[model samples]
Target: MVLTDTHTHQYYETDPVKKAELMQRCLDNGISRLFLPNVDSTSISQVMDMVDTYPDNCFPMLGLHPCDVKANWKQELETIYAAIKETKVYAIGEIGIDLYWDQTFLAEQQQAFRQQIGWAKAAKLPINIHCRNAFDEVYAILKDEHNQELRGIFHCFSGTLEQARQIIDLNFMLGIGGVVTYKNAGLDKVVEHIGLNSIVLETDSPYLTPVPYRGKPNESSYLIHVAQKIADLHQTTLETVARITTENSKIIFGI
Candidate 1:
């Protein structure tokens, strides 16, 4: 079975030996397709370097993460916007509002989110959004920017049924990750309510590791536990979950 980690940050490893070892673990686990999201100017090189090293297995996404939004966001976006043209950007992503950490850059985050949405639409690329404690703000921007050409995954979605419906109504897929495996995350109910078609799987690795590995650094290789958890939640099989979610990832990334 082929599992696609629609949102993962495998580029965090700089050592060639460690990187290869980690990627081999993912490949052996059948988590073959790794889509890496960009955080800012600082992350592009690492992500792109991984993409270069594993051209087929690893892919790059270009965008300024919400938490990285600062007073110099305009400059960062400009730098990101320029780089998208020079490389093959799989998506415009990991972008959205984040009030959980700091609200000082709320306005700038909103502006950056909107601008990146425009970039995604113009480039005809899907987006992998990162939202936290600012769903209302993120939803508002999405509503305003809604269009036939606008589509992507709501990365690491941990919201209510109403929010899930609203996201699906926007023709976007919900990116289910290790959060679903948490004992009290309540994402199983959300998954059951949304059905499989509107869902995709992710690890958001180096974070949100699944049960049995919780509290440790997450790896794409541990994705099988996540798929198994979703299968248990849906009363389906791991193969079924893998097949469906992998197809959903292919559709969104156009791979």
Candidate 2:
């Protein structure tokens, strides 16, 4: 059973010994594939470090997270877009409107989101959205920018069935993470209805840790738990979930 973590920040662990142990645990649990999305200019090195250490298992993506969108967002994009040219990135992502934190930067966030979407479209790559309380804002931009080149995952998706369908209609995959394992996250109901073909598993590690480890930090090794939760919700086997989701990852990332 080969499982894929479509989104993770396992690179945050800079301690070499602990990093190796973390990767070993992932390998032992059959989580062979992990996609790394760098949040901003500062995180590019950490993301690439993991990619360099595990070239075969870790894939890199470049983007400035919405929460990281400050007054210097233009300069941030200049650096991030330049980095995209230097590296072979699978996607331009972990980018979108995040109004959950501060509503002060809504305009800047929308502008940055549009510009990043343009980058993805121009690069012929997918995007990884990080929407929070600004789904409407994000969705609006997505609609305005919708086209053949507009595609990617809605990372850490925890929306309603209607919203899931709307995203599916856009030809993007829903990135399901550890939140689905929460007893009352209400994502299970949506997952139970959304077909597996439109879904991909993620851990978003160092955050959104699944149950049994909800209070602790998350890692890619815990991806199996998310996969298992989906299997249970869909009434399928773990192996089947692994196969289908990994295949979906390959189709999306083309790797």
- Compare the candidates by TM-score and give the number of the best one: 2
| Candidates in order: C-alpha RMSD to true structure | 0.8, 0.7
lDDT per residue for candidate 2 within 197-255, as digits (tens), equals 99999999989999889999999999999999999999999999999999999988989
Residue-wise lDDT of candidate 1 within 75-131, one digit each (tens)?
Answer: 999999999989888899889999998999999999999999989988899988999
How well does candidate 2 match the true structure in TM-score terms?
0.99
What lDDT does the true structure give each of the candidates?
A: 0.92, 0.94
Backbone clashes in model 1 = 0
> How much is the lDDT of residue 54 in candidate 2?
98
Candidate 1: worst-modelled 10 consecutive residues by lDDT = 187-196
Worst 10 residues of 2 by lDDT: 143-152
